[model samples]
Target: MPDSFGRYPNMNISEYLDFFARAYGLRGASRREAVERVPDFTELGDLVNKPIDTLSKGMSQRLCPGRTLIHDPDVLILDEPAAGLDPRARVELRELIRLLASKLQKPGPDQLTHSHRAG
Candidate 1:
């Protein structure tokens, strides 16, 4: 995950995603499970197997969040995720962010919702 999606001509989207997931310490069952959720989470659909270099800006944009989220960080912040997208894509991205924030409240460990105080 560069500041922008790099042109990995030899790698497909799945490979690209897996690379980041592995770097984030998600391995074995957890890595596979997390990677499996990316397509749905990013609305990547059938594009998962497509080569990275062939993706358009919109499709490439989807990779950003998917890559960062493979480990389910306690907090997520986006720096203009919709910056280069069209109006429709921007709207869709907004809805996606909202869905990610609101719909991901599944039961888990007993850690405080905010464990570390944000400075």
Candidate 2:
């Protein structure tokens, strides 16, 4: 799996978002609409031109959600979404997940389901 920084470490945030948005078949107004969603949902506005490698873990984590939602999928399945996040980032991710769930019309219990494997 690609690390949080993604494959294009040299690409700035706007370029990265635009590339993925376009790759997902978004164009014209749809592309603009998808690109517009990033800033609305994450704290990435100021970091738009910053390279992905320069982003902090929290900021990098925020990007993943935006990328996943660019196509506006009906369901989102995340595995260990909070795995490497710091406390604040984890909270932000949780809230974002909730917002996504609501927007995707998939409301349910607040808790996420996970399988704990005993080592």
Q: lDDT of all the models against the reference?
A: 0.69, 0.69
TM-score of each: 0.77, 0.77
Measured with C-alpha atoms, the lDDT of residue 72 in candidate 1 is: 71
**Per-residue alpha-carbon lDDT of candidate 2 for residues 39-62, written as tens digits (9 for 90 to 100):** 566768877888888887777777
Q: After superposition, which runs of candidate 1 have C-alpha atoms over 4 Å from their true positions?
A: 1-3, 102-119
Give the CA lDDT, 0 to 100, for residue 108 in model 2. 38
The local lDDT score (0 to 100) that residue 104 gets in candidate 1 is: 45
Local error of candidate 2 at residue 32 (angstroms)? 1.6
Q: How big is the positional error of residue 17 in model 2, measured in Å on the Cα after superposition?
A: 1.0
TM-score for predicted model 2 compared with the true structure: 0.77
